[model samples]
Target: MREVEETLAHNLREVREKKGYTLKDVVKGTGYTEVSISRWETGTRIPKATVLYNLAKFYGVSVDRFFWR
Candidate 1:
């Protein structure tokens, strides 16, 4: 469980970097605060389903990509 969460966090950060998006950009696109996004990236907080969906849509990736390899 912890491993999965860490993977998710790592993937989220990786994807955001790959897309050249700043925390502010994600905040604007996902309606989540920069602190929340930072927490998500650091594995300190897990996002709810709706937030995950919004992130996936904003990043142009499937939700599964956050979990699966």
Candidate 2:
């Protein structure tokens, strides 16, 4: 993965883990499919802006958190 993608993937996974949530749990909370969240966590796909915002809000984190990690 590219550096930015890697950081985002890592941060997403880390935050989810820290919150004790599974991919399925995120799906329920965000109204996104588990497959899509898994792809983002694996750096296989980047979320669109709205999706990213939803995920950030779901995780109670700022969007910048994904980039910084």
Candidate 3:
């Protein structure tokens, strides 16, 4: 689970950077608070399944992108 969370955090940051988006940009795109997204990216908090799904969908990524090894 810790590995998954860490991977999620890395992936989230990477995905956002790959798209040249700031946390504010993601908030605008996903309607989640910047703080919430920040926490997720920092691995201080994990999103719920629904929230994670929404984020992946908004980013046009598969949910599997958030997990590995």
* Top model number, TM-score: 1
lDDT of each: 0.92, 0.88, 0.88
Tens-digit lDDT string for candidate 2 (4-49)? 8899899989989998998889878878988888999999999898
lDDT of 2: 0.88
Q: Write the per-residue lDDT of candidate 3 for residues 1-69, one digit (tens) a residue.
A: 688889989888888898788999998998999999999999999889999899889888888887844
Clashing pairs in 3: none
Error of 2 at 35 (Å): 0.8
Greater-TM-score candidate between 1 and 2 = 1
Residue 59, model 2, lDDT: 85
Clashing pairs in 2: none
Off by over 4 Å in 1: none
lDDT of 1 by residue, 1-69 (tens): 999999999999999999999999998887899999999999999988888899999999999888865
On lDDT, the candidate that comes out on top is 1
Candidate 2 ranges with C-alpha deviation above 4 Å: none
- Model 1 — TM-score against the truth? 0.94
Ranking by lDDT: 1, 2, 3
